[model samples]
Target: MNDKVKALLSILESAGFSHDDLAGTVAELNDAVNDGKSTSIQLVSPGAAARYIKRINDENVFTARFRHSDEPDLLNNESNDERIENPNQDSCIVVSYDPAKQ
Candidate 1:
């Protein structure tokens, strides 16, 4: 696995994504990145990767039950898959959600 795959897997794990569906998600994400649909996620770049991962968890077959409601809307500006570079500044500042309220 390349850095993208590793980053994806790490994000998935942190968000508690479904293990059963990971293999397919990994393959799909990898393909998306390779095919110009999605890009590699960066964990060290001021929460850009983390935000993107949260959005992925909300959508698609591999659902994240504990998904964040206030996830930053970074995808809207993401025409291609690359680090947003301090995404929190360019993105919406949605407030955090309560896990118990969900």
Candidate 2:
């Protein structure tokens, strides 16, 4: 997996998203990014991601839910597969990797 996949998986894990849901969400996000529909994504805290998702809707960037609570006595809270696009956020911050340094 590439950095994007790793980051997406990490974000989804932290947010409590299920493996099944994560599969679709990651695919969608990766598609958007690769197609130039959206910029790169940064893994953030769940709360922060939620807030940011709400703030950005329609235009550029978007977010996919990746976590849910595990409930034994009640139904689990499903991760929302919502995408938020922010026009203002139109840049991808990436750094060149040096394998020799590793």
Highest lDDT against the true fold, candidate: 1
Instruction: Give the deviation of candidate 2 from the true structure as CA RMSD.
Output: 14.6
Q: Tell me the number of clashing residue pairs for each predicted model.
A: 1, 6
Candidate 2 on 32-89: residue-level lDDT in tens?
A: 5555454333322334344333323221134333222221111122235432244222
lDDT of each: 0.43, 0.39
* Residue 97 in model 2: lDDT: 22
Runs in model 1 lying further than 4 Å from the true structure = 38-102
